[model samples]
Target: MTDLMETLIENREMVQPNHANMLESAHGGNVMKWMDEVGAMSAMRFSGETCVTARVNQMNFERPISVGDTAYITAYVYDAGESSVRVRLVTEREDLRTREREKTTESYFVYVAIDENNDPTSVPELTVSTDEGDRLRKKALDGERD
Candidate 1:
């Protein structure tokens, strides 16, 4: 078993000019790519095997991340099946100068652990050992219910 908290992954990227769209904000594709990368990392951490993105649930871009702002991506495994791990991903825009943050996107990603032959393999059961881990799992579940 792997503790959910141990699988948590957080990544930050500075939105550069190349990563921005016409409006000088982070491009939706760029944000999605970042989310996928971090989500896979979290899944791999929990499964102890290479994972591939299987599905990405609805992704909503609620706000724009300015070109100069920092994009904060947080991902964690909330649940797992025999071979699949579900990760909750949240992206936020943070202004380093003001220390302000605003959520920009939210989505759930499913990854499947793979062996050296690229065949799906079973993943260990997930465990939540801390209050924070329990809260995160609940939040993901509640969001799905809503």
Candidate 2:
């Protein structure tokens, strides 16, 4: 079983106009999609089963991400119950030229493991074995802002 401290998932996507909304910034839908994708990876890593979205606790857009920037997403398992996994998602926008990055969004997404029949399945208890894991867990529990 992968403990919370040992679990890490990350992926990156380049922002394009198709990913942007009318405001010329990354669309909220696109952000949510990336969040779900990364969160599912974390949940699957911890649960060892396919995971489905149960709820999105909160989403905060800290800054705007424009087209041509790279959106870097990172997720990690923080807390878990019998079948649900709590994951934290952080998204950053990096300038393609200078490579300067800014935090574009952050959120906590909950996912539940599912069996072959698509029913909720059990997951291993998450273990926070390091200071970083503990801190991230605390940040998630701290609510919308930290």
Best by TM-score: 1
lDDT (Cα, 0-100) at 29 in candidate 2: 89
Write candidate 1's Cα lDDT for 55-108 as tens digits: 998898999999999999999999999999999999999999998998999999
Please write out the lDDT profile of model 2 over residues 38-120, one tens digit for every residue: 88988998899999999998799988888888888989887888899888899999886897888889888889999999999
Model 2, position 19: C-alpha lDDT score: 95
RMSD of 1: 0.7
Runs with alpha carbons beyond 4 Å of true place in candidate 2? 144-146
In every candidate, how many clashes are there? 0, 0
Model 1 lDDT, residue 32, Cα: 98
